[model samples]
Target: MLQGEEASFFVLCDGKTALPLGTAQDHKRVGEGDTGPNTGGMGAYSPAPVLSEAVQERAMERIVRPTLREMSRRGMPFQGVLYAGLMIENGEPRLIEYNVRFGDPEAQVLMMRLGGQVLDLIQAAAEGRLDEVSVAWADDHALTVVLAARGYPGRVETGVPIRGTEGLPRSSVQMLFHAGTALQDGTLVAAGGRVLNATARGTTLQEARDRAYALVDAIDAPGLFCRRDIGWRALGPVQDAPATSQPT
Candidate 1:
C-alpha cells in the first residue's frame, strides 16, 4: 500500500501457491488463534525460525533489494524499515502484506534476540547505514506469550486484578514486557487487550518453549490462552530439546 512515496512497504509472494503468509504472527484479536476482530496487536515474535537466514538473504537479493533499487530508479528513494510479510505453503514462500513500522510480536522477539544492540541498530537505520550494521544473533531461541483480558477487543473488562509475576527469572533468557498494564492504588491490573508478554530464551527452541510455558503456569490468570506449539514446527524434531508443559 505505497501512497505517492509517503510510506515504504514490500511483499514476498510464493511463486508456486499464492497464499498470504508473514514472517510474524500478530495477535489481532484478544483471543488466541485468528479469532475475533483486530486490535493494536496483543504481542508478536520474530526471526520466525521459518524464515531462515538463507531465505531472508534470498528475499533481500531477489525481492527487497530489487524493490529498493526500483524505487530509487523511480526517484521515490525509499527509506526506513520495510516489513516483508511472507507465507509458505507446500514448501513455497509467498508474500502476505506490508507495513511501515515493525510488527509487534515480531519486534518483541527480534528485540529479545538482538539484546543490547537495539539502540545501535535504530541509529544505523536512521543514518541510512544499515549495510554497515550487521546483525549478530545469539545461538538461542525466544518465545513470547501474550496475556489478554476476557472479552477483549469487543468489551475489555479493565481494572481486573493481576497476580503472580514476582520472582520471575530475570536473565538473558527470560523477560516480561508489559503491554497493557496500569497502576491503580499501587496494584497492577489488566488495562487493555493484551496485558503482558511472557518471553523466554534458551539454547534451543524447545528449551525456550519450556521456560515460557513454566512462566505461563506461574501466572494465575485464567483469561489468557497461548499456542503451545509456537516454535515446535520450526524447531522440528530435536532430540535434545526439553518438553513443554500442557498448553495454556
Candidate 2:
C-alpha cells in the first residue's frame, strides 16, 4: 500500500500547451478507517499539503508534461482536464493514473477554492487558448463531504427522501452540489449511492472540514452517512487512520 497522501492535480491541456488548474485529495473508501470497498468518493479536500510546492513542480515536470507530450506525439492531442492521481513516495511524486475530466468531490473543493476562475480556465482550454488564461486561487482551504446511501459501493437502497437541503448557507465560501439526486413528484430523494456533496471553504483545513461536516450534520436523510475525518491527515496527526482506496 502507498502510505502517502491522495494528491491529484487538474491540468488543463490544449494540445500544444498544458497548465495546472488546481490540486485536491479525495477519500474513496466507504468506511471511516478508509477500510471497506472503494466508492466514487466519500469526501475530498483541496490544496492537499502533502502535495507541497516542490512535489507539484516535480509532478508537472516529470509526469504531466511527459504524458501530454506522449499523447500529442501519438496524434491523440488530449485536451480538457487531465487529472493526475499522484502518490508522494519518499518525498518524490509518483504516477498513479489519470482522469479525463474534473473528479467529483475533488472538483467540488477545487471549484470552491478557485472560485470563478474554473469556468474561465475550462473555456480557455477548450478554445485552445490556455496561454491567455490565468488562475487566481484564494489562499484558503476547501473541503467536501459526500452523503451516501446505505449499502453504498455495493447494492444501495435508493428512493430515500432527503431533507434539510433547503436554505443551505450559500455565499462565496459554502455551497452544495447535487449528484445522485432527483425529484419525484416534488420530493427530493436519493437517486444513487452517493447522493449529495456539501462543500465549504475556510482559512484553514480544519475550519473547512468543520464547516463541511456541519453541513453534513444539518442534512437529514435515511441511510445517509459520511466520514467525519475528511481531511484528517492534512489537518494534523491521524487519530483514526483510514484504509486506502482507488480514486473515482
Q: Pairs clashing in candidate 2?
A: 33-242, 33-243, 34-242, 34-243
lDDT of 2 at 237: 41
User: What lDDT tens digits, residue by residue, belong to model 2 across residues 47-95?
Assistant: 8888888888899899989888888889899888888998887779888
Cα RMSD of predicted structure 1:
8.0
* Candidate 1 off by > 4 Å: 1-46, 223-225, 235-248
Cα-based lDDT at residue 195, candidate 1: 80
Give the runs in model 2 whose Cα sits over 4 Å from its true position. Answer: 1-3, 236-248
Tens-digit per-residue lDDT, 1-248, candidate 1: 32210111223222211111234544454433344566666544444655655665566666676666767778776655567766644334445555666666666666677788766766666666665656566766777767667665567678887778877877777888888888899877888866888888777767777787688778866555444445544554324322232122
Backbone clash count for every predicted candidate, in the order shown: 14, 4
